[model samples]
Target: MASTGERDGTGGTDGAETAAGTAAAPAERKASWRLVGPGIVVAATGVGAGDLVATLVAGSRFGYTLLWAAVVGCLVKIALAEATGRWHLATGRTIFDGWRSLGAWTTAYFAVYVTVWGFVYGAAAMSSSALPLVALFPGALGLKTWAILCGLAGLAFVWFNRYAVVEKIMMVFVGVMFVVVLYVAVRVTPHLGDAVTGLLPVLPDGSLLYTLGLVGGVGGTITMAAYGYWVNAKGWTDSGWMRMMRLDNRVAYLTTGVFVVAMLIVGAELLHAAGTAIGSGDQGLLDLGRILEERFGAVTAKLFLIGFLAASFSSLVGVWHGVSLLFADFVERTRAARAQGTGGEPPVLEVARGQRERSWPFRGYLLWLTFPPMGLLWLDQPFGLVIAYGVLGAFFMPFLAGTLLWLLNSGRTPRQWRNGPLSNVMLAAAGLLFVVLCVQQVRELPW
Candidate 1:
């Protein structure tokens, strides 16, 4: 692939000079078809075991009635990830850099949010990943032991590897996830006629909140913003890679749709048809595994459990690497400004160097995500912390959507790359949808 500056005819920003007085390196070229890894990583990360269980529960409750919501959710995420990639390529800036340009308040919100979010998320991810492992090898380790081990393993893998290695490993796990979920989907004996009819946008009676949840929660989170960082990590730093990046983003959500819809199929065909209800949370998956074992034998249940581990573990390491890269960039630019005694923006190249996966801040956050959260695994998660996590998490999607609206439509973006009417409409829809969801989440939180 040719660099963005070379292909798009837009040169780098004039003042983006490194401390050594060199211009930022131009974006490089690559085949758009071949640039598929970053999206895979994002997709795999976003749809962890929670997403699957949620889809399963939806299917069990409403029996394929909300299948359309899953598709819409993927479309919403596609729009968000595409706009993020466009901003990166068109402006040759990191998402943080753009957020910082918005104001110091943006930085402040992100700093506190990331720190608190990572603390809670790391333990949750490890335990989720360890669930299937313990199920498959029950006598081998306890849940807390397996969770701690999973956390350490993720930290080690991310700390030792770069973006390329991380992408490759995520893809392998995604393969396992696809095969097992798809196999169960095919075996579920779906009602083809009802599924076809579900393509229509009908909200079943009394299913408004559940339908909205499915539509808004399909395959998104802060990991959506991490897509741009992954694009840069893959060395696709210019408008030249925009087409490929969009394609990759679409592929990510498409894969996510498949994972989600397959779980829906399992829920509808197995649980709904049998009048069985699974419990909530990751344990719901364990409940499903037991049912699968009784019906299809131990081999099938083991395979699904293995797939579950792959899905959760992919999120663990992906977040370990992707979010850490974001944090490291923040540290690098902040310290660079302080050291220069000028509050001016740090050069793009300066932030680029800090992208090294082995950087100190990267490893520090990795350790933070790995070790501290283990406390929550042993002692129950504190009530206040869970409430705070929910509050911060609720606003993040809107924060991303509203900020993208500002960044993409403003002078910050190139004229050719600004959001078209359709993009704006979709983003506006996403912003509104998430705002409602955020309010509901806040109200539902037991303060």
Candidate 2:
């Protein structure tokens, strides 16, 4: 049952519950910080099939010439996520709380981002998830029909479950994704010499945009901002959890790095070697599936399809669960700040922490992610929304990178937990890179 909370006339939860319930909840975890779960959830969420497809296209075109960029992408994400998680652990406040402290501009950017980004992303995620299903059980259902089913399935899972169940299930899917991708990568017999030489920092001609995309796109998602919430969900709210959080963030990106490299290998050795071309987006994975069947056998093709399904669906549900929690926290934080009238300072509203998963805003956002987007699954996405999504999506990483630098460096964070020199350098570079990518995305849009 949803816990009854103090609500004003407008029906938003008034403040983050400052009661003992929120604090004690973290203590109930028996071996809480010892196990690695949130990182797996993040890895599963961030590295969706679309991301892998982009990596595959890179390999098919450049044949590992951009391999160094992929490695750097992983490192960059580690720094960003570490800074995010650090803010939560070091300050005992949610990221939204920190954002509230930064002034109203942060709020305006996030509000626009989650609203437009969530709707278009829901449809795309469901379509991507359904693609592998349609391939696996070809005549079982039509594409739109499968897409709706996928969306509903994700909705039901996230709606009924809490963080732990979500984490465990995501971990299983991550395992499936890892094994199948690795098998395909190894089966292709990648040239060791080329793989080694590809690690050098040389870019082939005409590959600048692709190189930028590779660096900015790997394992990066809106989910990175949600890492702190996931950490708090695991009952790791204080600086004591900082060590484990850093390790967790590293493991998350390491897993992602492996996924990126393995997919690139499949593209380099299989598609590139054969001089084969595949359609782009999730469809590219389908093209690869057909090739696997023709060359290897039915079993190999089916296994690849299964991995594809796992990758897509894991991302679908991970976003469903994680982002809703983010939205809930977003709502809760905004309401609390207004009630406190913090005069644009960090609201001292961190006392009673309610379970964001059980909050109305969280469930409402889950529904927002699920049902409304199904209309797009049937009809094509409205061209304007698509354009808006692309534009806003382009802006998000830069927004996140820029904000983390701001929040983690200023008085908003405790002095001890502030970003170090290396973190600053990595984040600034990430910010600059994303800004470049954002401009490219806008230029390519059909304005």
Candidate 1, run of 10 with poorest lDDT = 1-10
Model 1, range 280-362, lDDT digits (tens) per residue? 88999999999999999999999999999998999998899888878887786666555656455343343443245778998
Question: What are the Cα lDDT values of the candidates?
Answer: 0.83, 0.82
- For model 2, how does the per-residue alpha-carbon lDDT over 119-180 read when each residue is reduced to its tens digit? 98999999999898898898999988899999999999988887888988998999999999
lDDT accuracy of residue 115 in candidate 2: 95
In TM-score terms, candidate 1 sits at 0.92
Give me the displacement of residue 303 in model 1, in angstroms: 0.6
Show model 1 residue runs off by greater than 4 Å.
1-31, 340-349, 352-355
